[model samples]
Target: MSTILFDKIIFGPVHSRRLGVSLGVNLLPTDGKLCSFNCIYCECGLNEERRTRSKLPTRVEVKEALVQKLAYMQSEGIAPDVITFAGNGEPTMHPEFGGIIDDTINTRNQFFPQAKIAVLSNSTMLHKEEVFQALNKIEDNILKLDSVLDSRIRQLNAPNSSSFNFDSLLKQLCRFNGKLIIQTMFLRGEINGEHIDNTSESEIKGWVNALKQIRPKQVMIYTIDRETPVKNLKKVSGEDLEIIAEVARKEGFDVTVSA
Candidate 1:
């Protein structure tokens, strides 16, 4: 039950293996986790294990902290390549998510205009109009679609909503119309005695087909890079990821693989 929580609203100009020089913004409670999907491979650990009594940062607080960090970075001649919304959990869960995005955009424009605004979301909240529109406005709306199969998705993502429909999710994603980036986590192993693997032939076939239909601008495939809540999970190999990337490439989608 290992977990990591961002202690501040704005953290890191840390080099991200996928996003590069990134600045993180955590909209969830700093001391706990709040996410729609209780992903077994989440670096932040199990949602229940990391539960807290803390409140989410206010929109004004987020904007002020971001501005302060950006201003100091400016003085130190350090510019972030991207301002990423990802930390303990689903950032869209915040009550003022849309307002926070608006504030972030204004603040980013004032400091690092060249930097992109990216949100790494689990894609459970796409049904919300405000969340959908806010994601559309960002440079990188990286949404997770671990598998095309409903059964596999349930096992891998463990989405909290009973109303979550795989088919409906695909439709909502299609609305992005190539504006979004689809990010998949590739891993294999057993969880609670059930064997799981998304890198299988059938799994890859179905996933690639879904990608073709959704038609995202880019596809990012990566394996677990940190300590996960589930200890039995295994990281997909670099060679295996390249194989998956080729399948995606044949579909005419730009793919990036992180092993």
Candidate 2:
């Protein structure tokens, strides 16, 4: 089992393929996970023991810890590309998510002003006014929309019962008129002996329509690079990812392929 959960405040300046040298801030509990969606490809695995409420670090604790860590890093000549809000579960689910974002921005600026603030959101909380406002403050609001089709989304993401609308979610995403990066995980496999590829004609068409509607600044099409909780899941090849990128490019969207 992976013992990477953070019970405290700060955890790595881990090497990330997309966001290099990121200092992770896991607002979720260190003991277990908390999230709105139980994504099939989530590195944290399914939220088996679901909690009715989110277990997260207090806003003051997070602010103090981050400020201390960042100041130490700066003094030691350590520089991170970004301070990321990512961990065992969804960061936005924390009740003080908006305040935390504000604290991170203020604290990070005092220490590492050059480093950017980024949040890797599952997009489930976009409907919340506070969540939207907090995300808007970040430098790179990287949101996830694995598949636009309801069936494919249900198959791939397995979102909680509360978050079931794929169309409405895309419409809400369009409201973010900032440096938005939409991430799509391309995978091909059989879940319970059923096909789960989102690149099919029908699925891709749904995605394209959503992309046209959202009009994100960039589209990041990438495949699994880490160990997934699901054993039957298959990783899409780099060539296939590039092909998808080509389609998105032709459709007039700035796209990048990272496989």
Q: Each model's TM-score, in the order given?
A: 0.98, 0.94
Candidate 2 regions exceeding 4 Å error are 1-4, 49-54
Give me the candidate number with maximum TM-score: 1
Any idea what lDDT model 2 has? 0.84
Residues 76-147, candidate 2: write the lDDT tens digits. Answer: 999999999998788999999999999999998899899999999889888899999998888889999898
Residue 49 local lDDT, model 1:
94
Q: How many residue pairs clash in each candidate?
A: 0, 0
Please state every model's RMSD to the true fold in angstroms.
0.8, 2.0
TM-score of 1: 0.98
- Where is the poorest 10-residue window by lDDT in model 2? 1-10
Full-model lDDT for every candidate: 0.92, 0.84
